[model samples]
Structures are given as structure tokens and as C-alpha cells.
Target: MLKVIFLAAFAVGTVLADGELIILNNPGSVHFEGSQATNQSFLKEVFTVVLGYTPKLTQPWDGVEIRDPFLLPEALVSIVIEGVESVKSPRGKHFPLNVDEVEEVTWQAVSRRLEERDTNNTLVRIRVGDGLDALGQSALGELKPNSVDPASLKHLSLNNEEDQKFIEELQLLRAIAQKIPSTVTANSKPDVYWFVVSGLRPVMDLHGKDSEATKEALKLLNDAVNDLSNAFTDIYNGQVVVALFTNDANKLRNTRSVESPRVRREEKAGELETFDAAAQNSSDNLNTIEKSIQKLATDTEGLVEQIVDALETTTQDSEKSTTESDLEERKDDIDSMHSSENDYDPGKPITLRLSKRYSANYPVIFNIFLWFGIVFFFSLLAICIAIAGMDPGRDSIIYRMTSNRMKKDN
Candidate 1:
């Protein structure tokens, strides 16, 4: 499920964010080499899309060869070493070879940043337990690739150490997820990472990958993913994209042993014939690998389309959710504004009118003015009546004048 989601997102070029890629490449043989269950073609196509180039084949297929996706500047690539010819590059990367201090080296690779390094190169980390190597080829052969409870492990009493190592590796992955990126270069490519948890391939395959041990391992992985997803919930999709897929579904041929040359003539001839037969088998294996690569290249386009569709669907869903959330918020605001206090009715017109509640008691100034006018009117009326009733008094000018006139007439 994660493989589908992650591969889909990875194929989409529009959502490239400045994030880091963590690859866990578990080595496993291809179960149905050309069946629909195989993931190699899809993987190759995904890598080609992300990396901007396909892995170049330096030489023909050797039993033991690895290809770096980014083509790091310094890595051992030889034509032939001890009868082993370089395998045709499957347009893929190789697993780490050095077993000594593998943990330290693996962590170093994981933690190394762009600013810390002088050149701008892609980082690939390989991890195999040092203790796993200490068990040597004999014990390693006895135990499964990543099994902690192999019969031999029980006999050797190494269950605890193996379990501890697996736990530590899980811890390491969690740490890598939690760490802040100290160095990010100015690159246009998206930070599509792969975290290859090697060693489990011995127990896993294309169709037969669901073993109890594998399930346990995957459960732990799921836990780690959930933890990280919760931690960065806000930016899980937009910023820190997380997806998982099986890196490959095909298996390389098992390493072949070349016997020493015989001294007897008949033995030597028999040995030559055996070598020829082995060479033919080797040729057939090479053809299988080459055809697989071609198929991968051809089928990549289909995978890309499917992944793109998936990404589009995811995008549409996210956008739809945001829109719904926005509408919900707006509705809430409107509901609050048209509250019970207003006695609002949805069918009523929104027009408004002035309130009739403006009537109130007169102010002190209005009362004082009215009283003064009434009192002045009454006093004037009384004065007029008093003057008329009284005979013309000498104190008044009009009365004095009228008295003088009357006397003259007498």
C-alpha cells in the first residue's frame, strides 16, 4: 500500500519539495521474473524520472556487481576480477561490500550532508551488521539473511545480539527521520529518498515476501512510519513526503564457484567442458538481466502514468477537503452574525428602517424655558389689570399728562 502511494507521489514532478530520500534496499531474488507481481520496471522508471538519468552499464554482468544511481565519482568498477566479469548494470545501485565497521560507516553515510561534503553528489547508505559478518560464512550460510531466531543462531546463542542489532537499525531509521536537514543544496530535483534495509532479501521475494519474520520486520517499519507521520503531520505531504515500495522484484543469479585447474589431462579436459557449460549458463543469466532491464525501461512509462493519476486523485481530494473546511468556517461566521438576538428569518428582505423608540423625557433646559414663559405671561396680565383698576397715578407719565389736560379743560 505504501509502495503504491509513495511511487505515485514520487512520479509526480509538480510536488517536488526540498526533502531527503531514505532508501531501504532489501536484497531478494525475483520470484516471477516477468510476471505482473514484479516491481523492477516500475522502480527503474521511478528512479529514472527522479534521478534524471538511467544507470549506465560499465561492463557485462559479473556475479558480484553494484550500480550507484547517481554514479558517484569514486567507486571500484572493474571489467573482471578473479574470473568474475562485471554484470550488466540493471540501471540500479549496488549493496555495500565492506562488512567491517558497517554500522559506523552506514550511519556516517546517512548523517552526511551536502555542506559537509565538498562536491554535490547523491548519498547511498548500505548497512550489514558487523556481528552478522563475525558469524563468518559458515554460520551466515546456516542462518537466514535477516533472521534473528535461525536454528543455527539458537545453537550459537546469538539471538540476543541479532535482535539487538535489528532494534538498533530500526532506531537508526527513526533517528534519520527525526533529524533536521543541516545541509540542503540548490537543486531543482525533488528529495525522493530510498532507505534499503538490506539482509531481509534472503527471507523475502516477489510473491513469497510475507513470512512471519518479514511480517514482524514490516510491523516495526510501520510503527516507525506512523510515529514520523504523526510527528510531522502538518508537512507530511507538502514538505516531507513519505512513501515506501519494494525496490526490486527480480533476483540476480547466485554467485558461482570456479574450481582450481586440474593437473591430469582428462581431468583438465573435463574441467574445460564444465567451464563451457558454466559460461553458457552465465550467458543465459546475463540475457535475463538485460531483457529485464529493457522491460523495465519500456514499462516505466505505464507506471509513470498510473502514478501520476494516483497523485492527481490525492491532490484533488486534499483540495476538496480544504474547500469544505473553508465553507464550513464561513457558514459558522454567518450563523454567528445572524444570531437569535436579531430574530432573523431567512425568507425576510435584508433592508432596514429607523427605530420608533426615540421618544424620551424632555431635558432640564426645555422645562426651564417653558416655566419662565408662563410665569412672565401671568405677571404681565396682573400688572395690566392693576393699572386699569387704579386711577391715573402721578407716578406714571401717561397719568400725569392726562391729569394736566383734564385740569385745563375744567
Candidate 2:
């Protein structure tokens, strides 16, 4: 018996899941005729009676009509208000309040009313219809908070300076809500979630006549409407059942749904690829520089060894006179080279010295042939010294010396 009951419950739940559950917020009567009445009746029956969800109606006798009986798990509901209407609240008389505003404000009045009742469902998504276009236009251009009649302000009970400031903020919010656009493009997930808003109606009621206040109310209302519309539009674009109360429901009969916008995944992929390519190019350049540095270090070591050998050979005294002259001329250069020992690493520093005595002794060129021999020999030594302190390889004087010697022998 338990197994049979479980199976039966599962089947019913599956069937219910296939259709959408709609929650309607109707505070007043909306008259309809002809095809508009038919559509409203159809929608009401399908959403409330067929789907087994109750309509939240402030006035039951003035319930809206529905014409179509479509099963949609997701829906976009539009709230349409036709003309100027006022409702009495705790604060004062509120004018031009639409179904959307009322629903939001009512939900806030009762703590967690929607959430506690529909634990598994979300609040109905709402959109403003074009019927309120004239109101929105008036709010944008002609509304002013200071223009409200001071007589209507008598009902406001202000206890302190803070209360007045709070009232002012409420007036601003109401004006912002009024200036919001009616049509919204949807861009939300298909899942439904409840939204409860309060404190708006009282503010609207208090400052509805002030153009600035109305503009503020319109802006706030439009932001909320657009957010709800975008949330629904992101997921579904099919036909939606709209429930609204107006003197002429015929205006809402022709209301159409908007399609969801397309996302560009390809552009995102291209950007990722470009970033990866740049990273790889940078890595390759760094690797090349590292290898070049290693080669330079090895060549520098070889040049250091060549300089040490040349210094050792030049220091050997063949004659006493020649030794004294060479020592005196090379003293300054040797001292400078030794000072580099403390400044650089032992194996990294390159020191080069040319004998100053050679220049001083060969000041006169009376014996041209002898002078040429001395100049040539010293020039070769100077070249070796300069090359040891500079970059290595083919550009070095060592290479030139070897090549020239080889060519002379050949």
C-alpha cells in the first residue's frame, strides 16, 4: 500500500512540474471586453485553477480575465495601469499606484508572507507595459517635489527632524520609480525567485502629485521592473501570460514578449589565445638571453687568461736598463688594474697596461727604420692589451694577430 501511494504521488508531482505556477497580484478591478476578456479569462483559469495556485486578490470580485491556456514552466508577467488612481494607506492618500508597485508594497507589509507560503516557488516576474508610457513621460519632464500641494502634506506625522529627512528620501525614491521605462529586455535565468518590496507605496502616496517625487518613484519602479524582465528574458522567450487590472484590458491583449540576447563565446576564446601566445613569446626571448649570458661569461674567462700570460712575459727583464724603463712606464697602469681587484669579482675583472716609457723614449724619430721596428712591436703589444679588456671572438685583436701571421708565412 505504501509503495502504491508513493508511486501515485510521484506521478502527480511530475505532471505538476511540467506546467508553470503563477502568482497574481490584483488590488482592484480591471474591466475587459471581446477578445481581451477572453484572453484574460483563459490565462486566469490556466494559471490559478488548472495549475492549482491561488490568485492573491485584494478585491476578489474585480479579478482579471485570461484568454489562453498555455503550459509554460517560465513566464514573463506584465503590470499595466491605465489612468490616475488613488488608494488610502496608513501614511496618506497614494495616487497612480500600479499592480506591480502594490504587489511589491503589499508583500513587504506582511512579513515573509510569500516565502512562507510558497517555499518551493519564486515570486512572479514582473514587467511594466506601454500603457504607462504617458505617466513615465510626465514623470521624466514635468514632475517636481516642491510642486505638491501643502494641504496634502498635513497627514504626515513627523516626530522629529530625522522623520522629515526620511520622508524626503522616500519622496525621492517614489519619483525615481515613476521615471523608469515600461519595456525591458530580459536576461535572467529561467528559475523563479520571490522579491518582496515595501515602504514604496507610502512614499508614493505622500508625494505622488510632486513632479520631482513622481520622477523619482518612476525611476525606482523602472529599475525593479527592468531587473525582473532581464532575469526572465535571459532564460525563456516564449509566450508569457500577463495579468493586469485596467479600465480597458484591451490595451494589454496585444502585448508581445521579447527574445533573449545572444552571447559571443568565440570572441572570449580568441582573447584567451592571444594572451597565451604573448606569454610564450616572452618566455622564448628570456631563454635566448640566458643562453647568450652564459656564452659571454665563458669567453670573458678566456680573455682573462690571455691577459695574465702577456703580463707575465712582458715583466721578464732581458736587460737591466730595459727593465727599469718598463717598470716605471707601467707603474700607473699596474696600480689602476690592482685597484679593480676590490671593485669586481676576482675572475671577472680585466686589466690592461701600456708602457709609458716606450712613448717617452721614442719621442724623436731620427732613425726612421729603427723607430718603425720599435713602433710595430709595441703596436702589436698594445693591440693584445686592448683586446684583453674588450669583447672576445673574431672581433678581438688575438684573431687579427693570428690571421696576419698565418698570411705572412703563406
Residue 352 deviation, candidate 1, in Å? 90
What is candidate 1's lDDT per residue for 1-410, written digit by digit as tens? 99787456544421222111222221221110110121222233223322333333332222222243343212100110011111112223322121112222223432243324334443433232333343223211322233333452221222444445554455544554444232222244323333444433433332134545545544664565455333332322223323333221121111111122233666879899999999999789767766765566456546555645665565578553334455457555544543432443334567788766632344446778999999999999999998788866677766877786777988
Q: Among these predicted structures, which one has the highest lDDT?
A: 2
Misplaced by over 4 Å in model 1 are 1-42, 51-159, 181-192, 199-214, 225-251, 255-410
* Global lDDT of each candidate: 0.38, 0.39
Which runs of model 2 end up more than 4 angstroms from their true locations?
Answer: 1-73, 76-194, 205-208, 242-410
lDDT of 2 by residue, 285-343 (tens): 76776666566656655655665566667667454223545554565555455454334
Task: Give the lDDT of residue 325 in candidate 1.
Answer: 59
